[model samples]
Target: MRSVSIKELLTGKQLLQEITVNGWVRTFRSNRFIALNDGSTLHNIQCVVDFEKFDDAILKHVNTGAALKITGTLVESQGKGQSVEIQVRDIFVHGGADPEVYPIQPKKHSLEFLREKAHLRVRTNTFSAVMRVRSALAFAIHQYFRDNGFYYFHAPIITGSDAEGAGEMFRVTTLDEKNPPLKEDGTVDFKEDFFGKETNLTVSGQLEAEAYAMALGKVYTFGPTFRAENSNTSRHLAEFWMIEPEMAFYDLDANMDLAEDFIKYVIRYVLDHCEEDLKFLETRLLDEEKTKPQAERSEMALIEKLKFITDNNFKRVTYTEAIEILRNSSPNKKKKFQYLIDEWGADLQSEHERYLVEKHFKCPVILFDYPAKIKAFYMRLNEDGKTVRAMDILFPGIGEIVGGSQREERLDVLKQKMAALDIPEEELWWYLDLRKFGTAVHSGFGLGFERLVLFATGMGNIRDVIPFPRTPQNAEF
Candidate 1:
């Protein structure tokens, strides 16, 4: 008998075939039935085992968290609820899990409680479904870029300069924390560090990915990026994965197209392949009534929205226009924003972005040409001399999922921008050299991988979608 995937069993027509499955028991109901998941799919395989045939001693050891190998005959379920089931004939206990100590039980547990047992949370139905959706979305990301002729580039983790220029970085050093080297000016001597410079974890891979794109014509980097930001919100994470795609001979419009298409592709793939898991998440994770038909809830709405994005074109709006709309729509002059975006030059807050995408646009909106003073130095300055060629893709539920812009290809303009921003020119010599030698018009964007996972699974928090979330003040497991 060959092993069959749970998804295959659910979708396939053949029944009464002998199969073998190896997995940890999610739950043992009534001491005669078991719910098994092999991590193959989000849906668990329900097995009906007769304790009379098996030894009572052996059955006693098969607890909730035990690993087991079951040889069973698959049969079309005649039960009123389930579609398929397996009748077990032989059972082998591979590992035993004590019921008293296992963190995950058959009953309901809070998300905060599950976060504490991050190591074992995947055994639960919600986490299992989330992980499956996460895996599918990640695969879709790679497929989208690869199909479009994008070369995947691996960027360095430990870097000399902060790529985001945000000054939030976790220093990488070998010096003793208690007795650090001192300079003549009575400051810490960064030159004596392990890297012999002020090295920190990479905040973004865009700078390095740009170099490869300029050489290779089209390149993308997908890897872990670290941020030392202290604000612990549901959306923020200390360590997360980012997908950055850089294209040569491309501008802001082309970049937005790629971002939109990439998001649509991933969403479509996950919805198509992980239907069972999506259903599980829709029922359990989102807290929607399980009695309602699976298609009735907002998951269908999300699917419809994604299909709309995939089939139709995205709406483009300038930042100035968006600000004007916001100002006109609100009667109160001093309306309190979460991040306080009161003026035109200030950065857009999540509240403002959500309002525009959710209420005004009613679809994914690509807002471009933001104030240059608020954006990074690499973005190309527009003709107005005030706004830069930066764009942010905001979705209804998730705001600013993708951030990218056209690079300042001209050497003199880039140098001037860097000088105006007060960034050290010596540190970016190699980056500037690309422009001096043979830099063509190029653009790229960084898509937060966890955010994409959150969007795909409809998972609310950023911590739930990631396997081992590294958030501020939380690195357990």
Candidate 2:
């Protein structure tokens, strides 16, 4: 008989047909019912066994986490939770998971515990739902960009330039670390290395995407990016996926519009397509939040929060205006902010961003025209010269979901900014060539893929969203 997935069994229109199904057993109770899941959906199909028909040895192996193939008759479930089930005819124990040795149990497992057992976590309901939603969201991202006339661009993973100028990069080297060849000046020579010069895992693909956008009119990149920063926060990860879209003739306003629409489109796509997984997650979040104080709880539920984003317009506020508001706000005046905003040039921290999005605006907020000194050198300088055309989209729980800016189209102005920042002009000669030749107003922004998942799934830690999180001193999986 052909094997049918448990998901297919659950959603089939007709029942009472003989079919073979393969899946891991979630639970075996009363030596009669087996909860089987194949990772196709959050729900499992019940498999009923008649103890008198099976041998004692075969029945002994029908425990949780065991792999099984069973030929059964699919029928409407008499059980309370599920709609359909299988009445088993023949059972094959593909693999027996010894209850004493199996890592995943039928009982509730904490998210942290699951993180440690990353290899087997997907067998659980929570991670399976998260990963399914994650996969659907990824497809939604590609679909949104493709539908909008943007060419998908593949930027190099190994790059010679530090696009963000953050100075935090994971060096890609084939040379010996302890001892290396030195030049005449006693400096380690990278010329003898793999690329004949220093190259690192890409921090951001924006620079290369910009190059492609100039030629291709519009392009987007979705790939892995590495960061060497030693931030051990719930939001930080050593390696992550990023979505960056660059366009040739767009300004900061257009960039902001695109970013908002793109986010909403993908979110709506996930809501529509991943209904079962998202519903599971929504219930999971609501149950998790029940432990918190009433004052600290979310005003809206997970589904409501997602729908709110799609229904409302993001509030756009200028950096100067935000500074004025923050300086006068009760939190700043009462000294509640960890990093008080007493001046205009100070960078906004997470506390400030959270206040703006969660409390003041009570929705997604776009903060634009940040101080030139705080932003990257490539961002276009406004007429005021003190601020750059940078915008960061802040969500209620997650601060700075997206960051982007309009590029400096003037060759002389870009060259001057590069010089002022002490960035090697020679290294970016090709990037400079874009401005040197036929540069028009262009804009783009980067969306952290993991963070986006966190927001969509209502996952608290950034680690929980990704399959295997790489963080400080922890690369176990």
Candidate number achieving the greatest TM-score relative to the actual structure: 2
Error of 2 at 6 (Å): 1.9
TM-score of 1: 0.93
Pull out the clashing pairs in model 1: none
Q: What stretches of model 2 exceed 4 Å from their correct place?
A: none
Q: 1-477, model 1: which lDDT tens digit per residue?
A: 677777677764658888888888888888888888788876677899887899988898788889998998888776655688889999989989999998787889987899889999988878888887888888888898889999999999999977788999998999989999999998889888887888899999899999999889999999999999997888999999999999999998888888887888888898788887777665564464354576444534445545655665668999999888776655224665555555688677777887787677777789999999899999998988999999998876677888999988999999999898788889999999999888899999998999888877777689988989998889978
Q: Could you tell me the lDDT of residue 159 within candidate 2?
A: 97
Task: Please give each candidate's TM-score.
Answer: 0.93, 0.98
TM-score (C-alpha, index-matched) for candidate 2: 0.98
Give the top-scoring candidate (lDDT): 2
The residue-by-residue lDDT of candidate 2 on 63-120, one tens digit each, is: 8999999998888888799888888999999999999989899889898889999999
lDDT of 1: 0.84
Q: Residue 32 deviation, candidate 1, in Å?
A: 2.2
